[model samples]
Target: MTEALYLDNPYLELVEATVTAVGTDGGLYVDRSIFYPQGGGQPGDCGSIEWGTGLRTNIKNTVYSPDRSSIILIPRGDQDLPQLGQTIIQHIDWARRHALMRMHTAMHLLSVVLPYPVTGGQVGIEEGRLDFDLPEGETVERVSANDAINALIRADHAVTTEWISDDELVANPTLVKTMKVKPPTGAGRVRLVRIGADIDLQPCGGTHVKSTGEIGEVHIAKIENKGRINRRVRLRFGPSAESA
Candidate 1:
C-alpha cells in the first residue's frame, strides 16, 4: 500500500518518493504520494514528477489501483515513465489544489446553511455545488442563502479533522449528511472533518482549507430544481454580481 501523505497534510506541495511499481499503462506507483486520488466528489490531482538531473514527467492524473491498495500517478500520454526503484519528487499543482481545498470546505458550510440532507456534490476550482433533499413545497430564498453562506465564510472558523472508529460512526448515523454516498467503512476507522467549534461535523475524506476565512468571498450563483425534492445549489468564488 502506498503512503497517502495528503491525508495528513493537504498543504504538502512536493514530496520525494521511490518508484515502487509501474502500471500496465505506464502509471507510476510511488512508495509515498502527495497526490490525492479522485474520490468523494473531488477530482484527482495533476502535477509533475521530477528525478535524476532535472529529468521530469508530467503527471496528468492520480488514481488508485484496481484493488484500491496503491495510488497510481498517471503520466501524460507522450511523457516518459520513471523506472522502478527510481527516486522522484512529486509536485502537486498548489494553486489548483488550494482552490479545490477552499471550495470543498465551503461545500461543508453550504450544508450547514441549508441544513438539509445532501444527495450529491461536486467541488471545482472556481465553483462548487451541493444537491440537497428538501421537502416538497419548501423553497430556498436565493439572496438570503447567499448572504448566510458569505457570513459563515467571513466568520473565519477553524477547520480541523479527526479519526473515528467505524463502529463509533455506525453508532451515530446522524453524523453523515449525504444519503447516496456513505463514508468508506470496514477500514476500521473513518475520517471526519469539523469546522469551527461546532459549525459542522461529518465524515469526509476530501481535502479542505485550514479555516473558513480561507474560503474567501463565496456566493450562491444558482439554485436549480433537479427533481421533486432535489435542490441543486451552485456556489461560485467571489461575491454575487448583485452584491458587487
Candidate 2:
C-alpha cells in the first residue's frame, strides 16, 4: 500500500520516497507520496519527482488505481522512467494545493451553513463551487449565503479531524449526519472533519485548513439553478484575501 503523506500533513510540499514499482504503462508508483490523486471532486496534483541522479520529471497529473489502493503519477512528457527501488523525492505545487485546501474547507462550511443537500461540487485553485438540492419555495440567495460564510470565517474556529471505528459509526447514526454523503466505513476507520464546536461535522478525505479564518473573505460570484432542486453556488477569493 502506498503511504499518502498528504493525509497526515497537507502543508508538506516535499517528501522523500522510494520507487516501489514502475508500471509497464509508464506510470510510477512510490512507497510514499505527497501528490493528491484526482478523486472526491478535487482535481489531481501537479509537481515533479527528483531522482538521485539529479534528474527531475514533471508530473502532469495523478490518479488512483482502480481499487483505490495506490496512486499513479503520470509524467508530463516522454522521459527516462525511474527504476523500481530507486530513491526519489516528491514535491507538490504548494500554491495550488494551498488554494484547494482553503476552497475545500470552505465547501464543508458551505455544506453546513446552507440548508440544503449538496448535489455536486468542484474545487479549483482560484474558485470553488457546490450545488445544493434546495427545497421548494426556498431560494439560495448569493448575498445572504456569502455574508453568512464570511461571518463564520471571521469567527476563526479551529478545524480538527478524528478517527472512528466502523462498528462505532454504525451504532451512532447521528455521527454521520451532515448530508446525503455517508462516512466511509469498512476501511478499518473513518476520518471525520469537525469545524468549530457546533458549526460543521462530516466525513472528508480532502485536505483542509486548520482554521476557518484561513479561508479568507470568500464571495459568492454566481448562483445557477440547474433544476427544480439543484442550485450551484460559485465562490472566489479576492486579491486581498489572506492565505491559509
Candidate 3:
C-alpha cells in the first residue's frame, strides 16, 4: 500500500520514495507519496520527480487506484522514466498547493456560515466556488456572507483532525450534522475535521490550514442562479468584492 504523506502533513512539499511499479499506461506507482491525488472537489497536485542520477520527470497529474491502495502518476512530456525499485525524490508545486489549501479551508468556513445545503464545490488557485440549494425567494447577499466568514477567520480558531470508526460515527448522527457532504464510511475509518471546540466540525480528506486566520481575507465575488434551487457563490482573496 502507498503511504499518503499529505494526510499527516500537508506542508510536506518534498519527499524521497521508491518506484514500486510501472503501469502499461505509463503511470508510476511509488511506495510513498506526498502528492494529493484528484478527488473530493480538490484538484490533483502538479510536480516533478527526480532520480538520484540527475534524471527527472514532470508529474502532470495524479489519480487514485480503484481500491485506493496506490496513486498513479502521469508524466508530462517525454522524459526518462525511473526504473522500478529505484529511489527518487518527489517535489510538489508548493505555491499552487498552498493556494488550494487556503481555498479549501475557506470553502469549509463558507459552509459553516451559510445556512443552506451545498450542491457542488471546486477549489482552485485563483478562486473557489460552492453552489448551494437555497430556500425559496432567498436573495443572494454577498456582503453579509463575506462579513460572517471573515469574522470567523479573525477568530483564529485551531483546526484539528480525529479518527472515528464507522460504527461510532453511525451511533452519533449529530457528529456528522455540519458536514456539507457526507464522508464515505465503510472504508474502515473516517477522519473528522474540527475547526474549534464547537465552531465547526465536518468530515474532510482535503488539505487545510492549521488555523482560520491563515485563510487570509476571502470575499464573495459573485452569486449566480444556476437553477431554481441552485445558487453558485464564487469566492476569492481580496478586500474588494468586484476584484475578487
Please give the ranking of all candidate structures by TM-score, highest first, separated by commas: 1, 3, 2
Residue-by-residue lDDT tens digits, candidate 2, 1-244:
7888888788898988888778878788887889988877789899998886789988989888777788888888778778889888898888888899999998888877785767678898888888887887788766667778888999999999887878877777665443555655667988878999888876777888999999988877778889877788888885323223
Score candidate 2 by TM-score against the native.
0.91
The lDDT leader among the candidates is 1
Q: Write down the RMSD of candidate 1 (Cα, Å).
A: 0.8
Model 2: residues with Cα > 4 Å off, grouped in runs = 172-183, 239-244
Q: Estimate each model's TM-score.
A: 0.98, 0.91, 0.93
List pairs with backbone clashes in candidate 1.
Answer: none
| Best candidate according to TM-score | 1
**Model 3 global lDDT (CA atoms, 0 to 1):** 0.86
| Position 195, candidate 2: lDDT | 96
| Candidate number that wins on lDDT, 1 or 2 | 1
Task: Please give, for residues 91-204, the per-residue lDDT of candidate 3 as tens digits.
Answer: 999998999998999888898888677778889987999888888898777777789999999999998888888888888776654336677788788888889888887778
Candidate 3 is scored at a TM of: 0.93
Arrange candidates by lDDT, highest first: which order? Answer: 1, 3, 2
Of 1 and 2, the candidate ahead on TM-score is 1
Q: What stretches of model 1 exceed 4 Å from their correct place?
A: none
